[model samples]
Target: MLIGCSPSYDTSQAQQVEASNKQTLAQAESSLPHKAVVYQVFTRLYGNTNTTNKPWGTIDENGVGKFSDFTDIALKDIKSLGVTHVWYTGVPHHAVINDYTQIGISNDDPDVVKGRAGSPYAVKDYYNVNPDLADNPANRLAEFESLIARTHQNGMKVLIDIVPNHVARNYQSLSAPEGVEDFGFSDDNTVEYAKNNDFYYVIGQDFSVPDAINGYQALGGEAHPLSDGQFKESPAKWTGNGSRLAKPDANDWYETVKINYGVKPDGSYDFPRLPAGFEHKSAAEHYQFWQQQDAKDIPNSWRKFEHIAQYWLAKGVDGFRYDMAEMVPVEFWSYLNSHIKHAKTDAFLLAEVYNPNLYRAYIQQGKMDYLYDKVDLYDTLKAIIHDKKSTAQIAVDQAKVADIEAHMLHFLENHDEQRINSPDFAGTPEAALPAMVVSTLISRSPTLVYFGQDVGEPARENGGFGQATRTSIFDYVGVPAHQRWMNNGKFDGGQSTEQEKALRDYYQRLLNLSHSAPALKGEYQELDTYQRKQNVVGYDNKVFAFSRFSEQQKMLVISNFDQHNGKQFSLTLPQSLLKAWQFNHTETQYMHDVLSQIQVVYPIETQADGTAKLEITLAPLQSMVMVL
Candidate 1:
């Protein structure tokens, strides 16, 4: 007589076991903190409610978002979306077209500024906040300090940008502390290179602005006293991108000047080298190691940035987002970040290092808390979303950085990247559902969400100096969709469309669940290979599957990237996973998707050789986290 096998465990006792395990897992996760979620908002763009998106518009024509715009209501709304940190980009004083001459700030020559709003990376001053961002120009510092206190009161940390590799072409700090001098102030300008000199000079050539190109002229060819193609510099310094020309090409970083960090023209270091084996040590240890070295060994530029970071920290700013971090020497980061850690042990230090090869070096030796996971994970996911590649590559990319996954930060949208809903990208926000799920849940890395990403901002406005498909960081423009969520300063979704509201709700649910889930902090294993080996019908490159589990919880996450079709298949669990979970092939499991709250029951059938199989179904652009 033939007999069917029952489940190894009884369903009646499942709830008790799950409850006990979850308690244990929660306790463990408490010791190993959950991954952070960072919300990066361009300080100038986030609160701009003006709908008049005039091209190359002056600040009067197109309004600017002020520090007062981020009211308590706005901050609390942001905190409710499961954000732990708010990176206020463009806070530092940069060159601008507006006449701040009355406030002791000189008007930037229109020839040198990128747009009427100017580029935030070309910081004009380090000791002051952007005048454009304040409600009152003379009281700008107090206004910024109040904003900092408000952010802390709302229970989220604040982050500002620090561009150490370059400064505005006319960098002048008006509010420096007593006895402190501006960059290039104490340098001997006649030399090409020196250890203590702040800049590299060309000795005899005067600075020249680039000729107009692509039917574009400075300030739209409008006449201004300073726009006569003349800027006063006795000897030219190297351009921010290392162009030695007196007149840099329009494509070069022409608006800013490079800072010298003890590297000579021959590409040799004048600063002391970090010893081998230092990359694996803690930041405190790195600080101690540097403390024993002679202060004279450090470069002058490094000390200047150190003072700047300390100044911001003293104002209650929690951390920094280092711009073009790779452009500066890695050793400088080791020195700067270690010293910052010495002052505040829990300070968050994130960098934009694009080279995957240098990821480990920057994180370990440079003492950075996180580096952008762009070239590998983000690019692969993008290709898969457009069907240019397969889902299989995600596993390979994950394996490549398995050891340093925690130090890698993941995001689908940021200021520098095209919006997911833009015509040049996915063309529809719905198409990014699967990619967003994987980017937020597949690893222990922190997650980043740009301000307007959740509301499906297409970046359709052709703001001058920055084209369509990406929000303009260089011009005065309004973010239409984000303003809908702002609801005319109410900071509610009052004016948002139903579709936009639904998308934001999805983001809120996913982010909050990710923030609280203990199993996400545990081990991960890829399940696509096991399913493919069985040759299951409808199992294709458009679908991805993975599992995360701990002593208290286990979850199987699957996503379908195909926007036009659904997927149904028999998913097989490999022997390795069965061994890890200590579940026999005949176990009958009951689970539900924590995201959508859809309950499911699956009886895992055993093949003759003890392989387990469970059926799964996913709609177009749908992702599910089946938790047990």
Candidate 2:
């Protein structure tokens, strides 16, 4: 399971492997309950209304959002959407403009930052809250603490970003706790590699800023006191994107420096790999394993991050969404995540891991609570939405990950992805209905909804990034659709149009239903074959059907990806599911379409052998979650 050596397998082979993996997972019993619906809100942009939207606008021109913006009403509204957790992206102190040097904060060189507002992944201080998020700059941490308290009071837990892969090019932690040392403060700057050093420095090379003739510049060519295109690292450290060059290309993540987690330039691990088959152990067990047996020596970088995690956990933070977690060693994750679970057993540890081969290792050995299901289900669903792929492919994607399905965090959009309604994506917001349904209902996995995606925020703002298809994570700008829903900080949809309101209503209804039903728990049966049976008509590949059931409750989900036309189809329940569910077939059971609030008193038709066949019709771009 090396990086580029992923093994190739046919469908039958994959299924066989999956069946064995399922046995392994069933033995481990690693599946957590379906209880988390995460709402990912960009901490910097959620409440900003200044729509000047100038590319790389100054903080004053394009006003920054404060922690105060997530008022009780806003948190309650989000909770009402059935969100159990709010992932506040960029809550940590990251590199940015807007001088705080007067308050002993170092002035960030604009030439090295991504925009007037820097990338959230470019963490500057591990122990502090971002000053830009504070109404009164000095009380940033207190404001963030207040936001966390308010969020919990509204019955929602808090999730903040923990960027383990890298830090800003100029890494300094001014507000770090007393007796805490800065990241590179104690590093042997002249060494090419050191097990205890936090960052890897080139032996004799001087840091030189990349030439800006690539049409990228700080402030979009506007001037700042620190926009001199000069940073002072005598022996340049490795760039965050893993560029070892002294002068990293402009296309690379040159604004940040990569963290050295006991890894070497030769691609050799400096830490010990978990003994064979450690995949089935729980975080608590892993913690005990480390405590009982010091199998491998620990690194200082590991100790620093553990302290950082403990610091936030002490401050009432419930979970963390690790940035580019796969980039860091899964061994380090085992150490850090075990420590976290050792402290707070239920603390959620989410990671961004895309390699299919690495999923099991990260989940079992690393003990992560969740991993982004981007490369598998999300990609397939997006392709199906755009008519670039078939619905049949979804079954393959799902089957491939059947073992660890519950740990996969499902989402249609997030900060790094293209917006649903963007031209580069599906041009219609309505297309999201079926995608969201399939993503949320397909498994017992956690569901995530980006803040403005509920109202179809096509991120078309040109904020000096490569492409504007994604909301500008780099610059200072207001999200137009989100602002209308914000209603000038009213946290109400007062200015939203009829279409926007209806779209939002659909989200509110569907997301709330995600938790209200018992269908999300134990067993699931796909109904694709039933819908397209031998004698059925009016159903095409444009439609998908599935069922979710527990002993107490059952749900049959039907979604229409055919956005332009209605569909009339017949459903034929499989004898296998019928036996598995042990449905009471002694009488004709009336099925209630909970989504539409419609009921079929006597099923569409009942066959001689006690099997049920129901003929149903769906509106264009509609999804039905029916209870039987």
Candidate 3:
């Protein structure tokens, strides 16, 4: 059983103080049981055959596209990056309506129908694969299966994106039972029946007319009459700006209908309701009906997801990348996990929950295995790389990172968010190296790699919203490029731009060291630095040195976090341990002697210890961990 701490403690602290008070804390109290790396893929832009043989392809407005030449080969390359899981963007069917013939994209412009497939988030159908991507069913499945098999063969797992929050506008019309008037209506009655009375539309009577600033619009108007069984006036409106009657509602997902969480007929607490449209029935009757529906439909959905997972798992899938998992409810995950655990208990489930505080609520529910710890990672990276904070501050950030790792996923970028390679983050390939290094170093959960991040794939043409962002990466298809280049290197092809290589090597070294050292693995203990002002950090168990210390194999790790090229400092060993010991740089494994008096060099020397008489400098943003 995976043990866990009380999900209530605050993790934002300067450092881990009161060590004696925390020693009795169990490893389960430190973090959750998941620790696997995840890689995110934007399937559309991952590869294209026609352009540079890169794994990305372009898409037009009407949703027509060619097979990305890079899918199969790119999958092979992604597996070699030492990641355990691969998260593909939504594979569900989607469609885009174009008002004109012109094709281009503009920032913050919603009406312009640039020739691009609308975002996959605007899901068209849940049951069918995107036609463009399903060119050769057998081949695609085989390729996907091969990917999964390879991942699992390498001891990994897989997860497919499932959009349960809302269905595509065409979905209800396409899949709803015949004569279902409840398909597209916005009224108190329909809303009550559809969402089980858990939610209410904010109307003019209850509140002032909502403005367009937040994308609010009136539903029933002179041009558009209210559908039957719906209120004549509603807050929902079609934001798509087309004659299509079934577009998602602007206020509450115009294309997708909100699900009703069954509430008491007396308008009290909420509960689950029947899936199929059934109203005017007693709560007991409704409960029984929903139970029957769940017994049949949920099993099928579960089997479908499981089969999708198996397809990749059979291909050697490393782990899972879950999307909008919080929307699915705990019951569904509990059922899915029971079976998935049988297949691979070690399989990582990296969920996407943007808010760190909300993550705690989910962890307490035990509904998920892990959540993306982006907030902490973001704070740490920004402070160190952007704000240029001190090592002590960075150490403080690392503690929070450790706390989040106890129960969430961590990464620099993923499919749902903008690419780190975007213009916002120094648009050049040079940005990737430091980004990768910082991401890999402080990642508490399994690290996540957005697709094409390794190869320096450019940001999607249009903020990654519609077709512009869905380009394919099949351009690099059938090419014999160095896999290392894909894993680590700048697009410029220069030796000075080898941040990827260094970071890649660093990751491998760290991961390998973690595998070999118990202290580095399993659970982490927040160490203490006697001099916070000096920006020096130390951990208990004499594990602070740059070497691994197994009873039979003692090692120490130390670092000079200064920002300059070559500076030196001295470290005092804890009085409890012997002074005469051998030390090795964690990355280089070079042996060095450490006497009672030790001197170390750093590139940027921001930390100075007046009491211990120690001063060290490190290259700008440079950090090192030594082993003794």
Candidate 4:
């Protein structure tokens, strides 16, 4: 269904739709478990205490954080904010500038690496951890396992990245299990497309690194033995971003090579297709279906990744965050993820998928637990906060994905997004408070927060690959705002400023609520539409409201996005909510704002028509969660 083309339903029509929805939602909640809160931390940057943030700096100049830095106190402090899973990004062994030749690790070609510390997505070895993150390079895998054990001991699950769609340009795995060969170990180099080939090839052409263009060169024009403007692939493979050129543009994902999952050059799938009506089937059924199929019919790359996931699961890793999931075939996910579920039924699988059209296919058919809701909810909230869109548009966006709401994960900031406090974005963390509240409590889906997001990290440093608003994932750099909270490895807020401390306190309260609130795991009903129809004097499109309720708890969440004006209005609740909560139509009800430390109560006055209204006054950019 087209999102914007759908007509807005009237109150009676909405009531009928929501009544059915509430029932379906309640049943869904009964079967599913509690909500989750994910804390995403860049492994190399989280514990780095170095103050130096020189552009394109080396590991020595800009020291890297080690696996040992996540001490018990640090894990406990992270758990204090109610995080259920910690995503240690860039944990896998990837291409980098450092030479570990003596330790049996070959030097990576600089022409194919993004920075001194390389792109984590360009994974080199799936069986090992990054050498840069370990105190003893030889003991990196053991150290990472210790970190995993530490995370699990703290009552949190461990999540690591799995870049399934691609690998480093010079992919090599030295730590594969006995008799398990590396990717592309025995492929026919002459053919462009083969059923078992691991990578797509440009036959007869040699791989050439794009020359320096627009004043940009490998390693920022620095000299290195591997930066000789050439790479050694005789039969060039396709670039990670699907660029077919032997010498892809510098702006393309030139550092990585695309993995083939039986997708031919003609865009036809070489593997078996999902039978009709399989999207409605459960993961276990999918697993059973695949188990019945001939093992030789499945693609070789799919089986390789399935073994890789099982290998990590055997080592106690809890879940995976799939990068660029849409680039690969959904059929492969159905095959591999079904195998993962067969091994660990409750394994957490999150995918980075942006296309709205493919949301349901990836979730239901691909067996993904969650997908990033970036194009719809996150974009709408950002526009509303910036005063370029109306809060009412949120209702339209939500309606588009109503059936799959619980599977659409919500987040305000991640490594790919600009910081909330960055000048290019909201310019102040406080300005985004309203949006953050709505993103977290608006659905039953999981909520993710970046490591430095709680303390208002602006990401203002111009480290390496051109000065952009986002934190540099490609370079070795210190995150100053996050370092302040690190307090030189103390894991205490000893050096945080007043504003930063207050912001983190608010995050702690909000995230803890998200983790513990039963109503958040229950059904949702929009209060924005009913309130808009009432046309209260001070209420405008800038203020949005919603209600979430279960048998145990009920809450009304409201937020004011207007940055220049305070709002005074009579917020209304429709009869649907009244029936859901079984509230008396003639008597008044009281609710206290549970979001703030200071106590404040509001009275909901019920009328003869079973509708209720509450007089509320909110400061600019303020939000509230009132509980009954």
lDDT winner: 4
Q: How many backbone clashes does candidate 4 have?
A: 0
Q: What is the TM-score (0 to 1) of candidate 2?
A: 0.94
- The lDDT of each candidate is 0.86, 0.83, 0.40, 0.88
> lDDT score, residue 528, model 2?
83
The regions of model 4 sitting more than 4 angstroms off are: 1-28, 31-33
Give the residue spans of candidate 1 off by over 4 A: 1-32, 584-587, 599-608
For 492-563, candidate 2 gives per-residue lDDT tens digits of: 799887788888988888888886667787677887865555556877888888888887787788888887
CA error at residue 612 for candidate 4, angstroms: 1.0
Superposed Cα deviation of residue 627, candidate 3 (Å): 3.2
Candidate 4 lDDT by residue in tens digits, 144-230: 999999999999999999999999987889888998878888888899879899988999898889766778777888989878888
Top-TM-score structure, candidate number: 4
Candidate 2 versus truth, CA RMSD in Å, comes to: 3.7
Which residue pairs collide in model 4, if any? none
Two-way TM-score contest, 1 vs 4, winner: 4
Q: Residue-wise lDDT of candidate 3 within 357-461, one digit each (tens)?
A: 466444433235577766665655544434355434544555654544545555655554544545554354444344444444333345666655554444444
